[model samples]
Target chain A: MNELALKELLYKIADDQLILGHRNSEWTGFGPLLEEDIAFSSMAQDKVGQSYAIYQMLNQLGEQEPDTVAFMRNANQFHNCQLVELPNGEYDFSLIRHFLYDTAEITRFDFLANSSYEPLAQLARKIKGELKYHTLHANTWIKKLGNATEESIGRLQGSLNKALPYALGIFEPSPLEQEIIASGFFAGEEVLKKQWMEKVELLLSQTQLNLPDWKTIQPVLGGRVGQHTEHLQPLLDEMSEVFRIDPSAEW
Target chain B: MKFSKAEIFTLLEDVKDPEIPVLSLVDLGVITKVDIDGEAVHVEMTPTFVGCPALDFMKNEVLEKLKENGITQASVSISFKEPWSSDKISEKGKAALKQFGLAPPMPAHLFTDIEVMEHVPCPRCEGTDTELKNPFGPTLCRSIHYCHTCKEAFEQFKPVS
Candidate 1:
């Protein structure tokens, strides 16, 4: 790949993580319970940390400094899916989103673990390890909410139904999808989407929740290609405000 | 190769954990790889956990250690693949944990075993009659437990995810 393409690819990956991390962090102190609060916050931190690593890789590739790459990107340039950018609705909604995203992330990281790109492969391996715990945390809550009061189950089901279409946005392939897959930098997007669906179906079955009709929902858009909801601009502003104030200042 | 394996290993030994200054991060098994090319040394490491608060400090520690060891052209790179796990704790680090009065973690897979439910011996009292109060303690890594015999509360490292 040419330098510009590689840099763009790295930005897409890094920006996705950064946006999702900011969204998740918004739940730090507001989760329904204390243990969950800590767990979600921890996951948010991991997302940011992962983004930081990707940014460092971008720097090494001689694209731009980590701060500029993260802070300077306009909303449309971000590649995260609409699923992650949506507001944390209710706790159940957040959990539903977490369920879908974590499962997909685990599958993606598993493929990346074996990526032909040595650095990404190594990074994926590391992220995949942490993801095991994330899956556990998300699964625990899903089961709890699924088995709780009728109200809880109803809420979860509603959230799951509402979120499923947007969750599909995560699978939207970037323009470089072919090159990335052909170069073995990542697995084919369709295969990954299939695996993700299988996993989601299995998990839903375990929870006795109905699988949303994937065929009927209009797929949500804007994440993979950098189009995002209004939620992102403010999030980016808050996240980068301090860094932008003094780019030369040591963090 | 510019540097011998033994010399490279010794230089890594100087990479200490910023949180716990007494122990080298390598001894903690956080340093995963060391590559040498002539006079250049490249070190690859991961944090003790994802989003560890001490990551920046640890990164600087690696660079400082290599520089202090006379490696002028050394580079320390960070990775997140195969994220750090307590399972990677070196035997030497395990011993150090024991000496610090923190019980080494029981493997998560073996957590359901009755043997693991048995009280961990208190480091202060050397008594096994302890009761777990809760799974979370002072840190994400520990659980709060108390020894009946010693009448003292102690923290035990929980087998964390």
Candidate 2:
């Protein structure tokens, strides 16, 4: 088995969940409405829990403790795509990001569900089940906001366009993409991206939103390789504030 | 005197969900397995939601219930090997939820295939003309629905799959 490739794959997936889950958790008490506040927080818990599970798998593979690995990692050490780490600009942007990112995630879980790796396939089953609601939440709101009043439609459309490039970055090829694919672990990002694009197009079509042709967009890349936006480090620092107070202390 | 799955299940019936106390963990299908080995009792569980805070509470409750029932040694573990679905909820649990003024969970297949159900069938009025007031409710496990006929708003358990 290609351990490095598998570990790298796990890192990216785990990081994506953790970072986005952190961002979503910020919505607690601050969502556009009370229901949305609870909804985002609910999904945030699932995302964080999912990340913890995958990190536990990593610990089995000889990585650090889940707490140390997650709370101690610097921005550049993270393997999550740039899209997940970006600031939640507004409800419109946050909603758009959720829609675009989750579309790919559910697809990734589907691919991983049938992976030759037994552990990943098992984890995928549980993760996919939880992600189904997240995508459902995103799609329902996207359609509602995408086809709503002029202001709502305009806000979603603006955010959608701004988020497209970053969303494409989610499929940035891994350093050991081929090794991972050759081991029958995953079908590779190219396949996942195609499926994501198709799914996104289909859903976007249902609303008044417009998606630009794929060929014309420059995909934002580099979060998988540990490169990240300015937004990540501050978030990480804030996250680990209490944990860093005393690494040896138990909560 | 000996312990069996039937009695163990009966003992666990008193362990209710923290959020919705009307239904027991067994009724929600969270208690998937109960096994007896010599003097050790092993219990396997799955959470209704991956992030349900009540997981630890439920596990502790199970252990306490078993110990109180004279099974002093017991272990309760959460299993994530298989996904959980609302379809696993018992008929008694569904009725309990409705009688408690909360709508029962819809079939898993019907809930996930679409964003929201057009007709939720209000728990109070049994009216199919209920509107999805919001796909999200006060809690993660439910959604808000309003019955136009009864002019009352209620919550339905969101099908988890």
Q: lDDT by residue for model 1 over A19-58, one digit each (tens)?
A: 7778778887787776667666777877887888888888
Clashing pairs in 1: A80-A223, A125-B81, A125-B82, A126-B80, A126-B81, A126-B82, A126-B83, B2-B38
| Alpha-carbon deviation at B149 in model 1, angstroms | 9.1
Candidate that scores best on TM-score: 2
Candidate of highest DockQ: 2
Candidate 1 RMSD to the real structure: 4.2
Candidate number achieving the greatest lDDT relative to the actual structure: 2
Model 2, B74-106: lDDT tens per residue? 999877665568888899999999999988887
Task: Give the runs in model 1 whose Cα sits over 4 Å from its true position.
Answer: A2-9, B1-16, B33-44, B62-75, B79-85, B106-161
Query: Tens-digit lDDT track for model 2 on A58-143?
Result: 99899999999999989999999999999999999999999999999999999999888887897787678778878988998999
Question: Which residue pairs does candidate 2 place in steric collision?
Answer: none
